[model samples]
Target: MKKIILSASLAFILFTNLKADAQIKLSDIFKKVTEKQSTTSTTGTPSSLEIGQGIKEALQLGVSAGADRLSAKDGFLGNLAVKILMPPEAQKVEKTLRSIGLNSLCDNVIVSLNRAAEDAAKEAKPIFISAIKQMTLADASNILLGNNDAATSYFKRVTTAQLLQKFSPIVTNSLSKVNASKYYSDLTTQYNRLPLVKPVSTDLTGYVTQKAIDGLFIEVAKEELKIRGNINSRSTTLLQKVFGYADKKKG
Candidate 1:
């Protein structure tokens, strides 16, 4: 009877302790969950705003470097990775011209296309900077935890339309400045005049605008890769702090 009584008391105490411990654990879990749901990541890492700032600085570097390189003479024409060429739709035109010994005209058209892209690239910095300023905390967090080109992809997705709108006039002016239209007109006029060949259109503004944007993004991606992969590219304390977290998370 004594043993039975002792066992009952022990069980009662155990039950009470278990209840208390469960309550404490539950409280701690709730606290942690609350903190997790907060708008920023501030535990042992930079805050979301700081991350956003770092990203902007990084993108600024990327955009500035890319735009500067591409704005230089032969920036696109010389760089095979991003050189603008005859559109696929116009491939037949190029072939026909080349076959007829109009290779110089084809060459001029290709050069002008690259030149227009280079001319429009110089104006991309301010637009990209403005877009970076509007990045949300969610965007910062996602980018912080994302792959090397993730930020670049996000910028492209958000800014492509605006960039198109902005790049149009610059490209248009560039085409005129470099006489790209005249060269294209010459190509099409010759091609259409040939018997048994389908008529080709002369306007290339839409194609140039799209291709130039694509080339710019390619350059931006290269800069992003450098920033993510190279310590030297993290040019500021904010970048160091934010990217440090990214490295840890990546590992």
Candidate 2:
């Protein structure tokens, strides 16, 4: 009877050990499956933050490149799209002055306006970079999803007021330094000498400031359009992919 009890006890102990080992094996398999699932999830897609950051980086790069192009020699002069043209209000005066043999002074005024624009554009790079850096997720989304000039428009909207404040004075100083005021004075004197037309006075600084801003926006729009339409202009896989998504949505 005692020998029989001993054998039964051994069998029970063996069964318990087997059951424990099986449970441990099953737990290990479950852990491995959980770990694999976690790895897949992590690798499968980017987080929202990551996506936002990528968009911001693309915008910043675009802005930097675009601004650099604008600041280069003959950048505005070479690009007809953004070339500084005579203001409509001043055009009449310009023509009248030129017709009366003040052509040299008219040319000087035009050249000085463009020069002021060029000088003020130098200050735009930092402002543009700062604005790009401050881009929020909403801003990024709008830029990514809006029209071809959306990004340019966004920058214009956000930076215009501040840019004008910062740029106007510089433009004023540039014009004065380049003797634009004298040229205008000479032209106006010539115009006033005309008996048919009334003596007209205008603010050279304000007119030039507005024109400079307009020219900058025109160039930025061109850059934005290039990026939107030309894959080669993207310059990066992220830009291509993000803008590709935007194009797809449009189509």
Candidate 3:
């Protein structure tokens, strides 16, 4: 009886231990499955969201860097891609005045106009950064999926009016500082002195503002194209991957 009871008790203990071990293994499997499900649920939808965000961040940084590059001392003067040229409307006055032997003054006015544009570009960096920070997921996705210059176009569309308003005063001040006003006045005096010519009048500030904005967009487009076409220009891994996807779509 003692042997029988002892054997029965040993069997019971072994069976209980085996059952406990099996339960632990089952619990571990359930934990792994639950963890995987949670991870999948959390990550699946948000990955696309993150990709869109990353592209926008890349574009914004690219614009800021590009603007900074252009705002330096030789930014406008050095970069042929973005150098400000005289407006066509003002060309007639410049040509007529030069024809009347006031070529030096005409040259001065043209140079001063470009100088004012360069000075006004200094103000654009901060404004552009502000606009960049305001970009949304929808905006990002659109920019990513759109044409090469789409990001720049979106910036121009949203910020051009506000930028114009902000730029006018700065351009006016720059023009005055650069003696553009005096140059314009001298040119106008020479132009009006021309016999049988209509009075040569133009809004120096407004024209400079518009021209400066146009030049900035040109630079932005150049940067955008670089980022799209040149792998080296895409600084970050995310940018490379995202834009690489774009390149594949184009292909």
Specify the highest-lDDT model's number. Answer: 1
Q: Model 1: runs farther than 4 Å from truth?
A: 1-44
Q: Which regions of candidate 2 deviate over 4 angstroms?
A: 1-47
**lDDT tens readout by residue for model 3, 26-139:** 999999999887555422223466657666667677777776776677677677766665566667887776676878887677677777777777888778777777877787
At residue 235, candidate 2 shows an lDDT of: 70
Sort all candidates by lDDT, best to worst. 1, 3, 2
TM-score per candidate, chains pooled: 0.79, 0.76, 0.76
**Candidate 2 RMSD computed on C-alpha atoms after optimal superposition onto the true structure:** 9.1
Per-residue alpha-carbon lDDT of model 2 for 1-251, expressed as tens digits? Answer: 99999999999999999999999999999999988876554233344554466567766667666667666766665667666656676678888777768788887887777777778888887888888788887878777778778888888888899888988899889889989888878777877887888777877777877776777777677777877788787676556556666777788
Pairs in clash, predicted candidate 1: none
For each candidate, the alpha-carbon lDDT, in order, equals 0.86, 0.76, 0.77
**Candidate 3 similarity to native, TM-score:** 0.76
